[model samples]
Target: MKLLLTLCFTCALLITAESLNCHVCANQNCSTSTSVACPAFSVCSTVTLLRRSGTSTTVTVNKNCSTLPSCPSLLGSETEWSVNQGFAREARRQLCCITNDCNMRTLAVPNSVINGRQCPGCASSAESLNGSCNATVSCEGVEDRCFNSTTLNSTQLMIRGCISNNLCVLQAIFGDLLSGSIDITCGAPCSYRMSTLLLTFAVAAHKVLL
Candidate 1:
């Protein structure tokens, strides 16, 4: 009887260990998030992104369960870009926590200050391929490396921006673990555009790395 009781106790511990709870929300307001059990091997994730296009700016926050354990390697990374002065320019940070509902707190967006580096910035889609940009963005903060990435999923999207060296390397190392594959190429000298150089890619907030 004692052996049977021990087996039952072990089973209970296993059950508890298999379940993880995390807060889930997609809105900027994460204060009213719902708690739900995540799948086995999943952890809580909080992602904050700030995007700017022309004169418009938006901040977005998301919390959910994630299975990618390597995502935390990008904890404080930021990207900057401008496309013809009116395309989607973004700065993003991600956080991963192992405790239940640990992602309830929202992360702040990182600020963009001219870091004296520059990169070619552009975006394209299958429907409307711009192919190139005449203007280049002066990179900000730790965005010392230039990158070009193409989405391999159904979206058919391509992005070019300035990224930190660590972010670029981590993305390459963990590219296989992400949801969808992205072909990323980094490095290359960014020359100024004599006619169309713009400061449109400046970030909205200060250095708020996760």
Candidate 2:
């Protein structure tokens, strides 16, 4: 009788442990979907040029994340672990965007005649008039905003740049784990930490760009 009781107790304990373990996996997937859905500024709009002259330009601006589903709700239960995790993920992403200095590489334009006019000189005096001028120029201007968005399976984070022209620029993508609504629970800390850490690693390694 003692042996049978001991076996039964052990089996019950094992079952409980399995249930808890399942929670961990579920939480991880949820957090991942949230991160995937987190919208960055780039994904919302494409780069535009309001005015481009002599290697410089002034771009208009738009900074609204309402269209994105992943935009974190500032009004939700702040104390909840999922909320904290989401905020933390956003913070870590913002850090990466700032620290990594993710911007377009400006290619030097060669001095050449465009439509029978001498083209303006680039920073480098050496004009590429003789070389092929087909190279496209990618410049970084001010008024670029980043934000988060929610989606069905993944969160969409984007960064939209306002250029001189009236056009939307989609800059980058950060796919997270959660989608739709996030679960509010204490078991989300690990998921949040792991997701942010993965983002940091990808940024550092240049696998992900802003």
Q: Compose the digit string of candidate 2's lDDT tens values, residues 1-210.
A: 999967855553343332110011113212211111212221111111133434553333211112222322121111111111111211111101111112112112211211111111122212221222222222222212222222323442221111111111211222232223322111111111135777788788895454
Instruction: Give candidate 2's root-mean-square deviation (CA, Å).
Output: 24.0
lDDT by residue (81-165, candidate 1, tens digit) is 2222125455656676667887777776756666666776653332224445444667765566777776677765556667666
Lowest lDDT sum, 10 consecutive residues, model 1, at: 77-86
The global Cα lDDT (0 to 1) of model 1 is: 0.60
Local distance difference test, each candidate: 0.60, 0.23
Worst lDDT run of 10 residues, candidate 2, spans 78-87
- Angstrom error of the Cα, residue 54, model 1: value is 2.8
Cα deviation at 82, candidate 1, in Å, is 12
Residue 165: error of model 2 in Å?
A: 23
Report the lDDT of model 2 for residue 87: 13
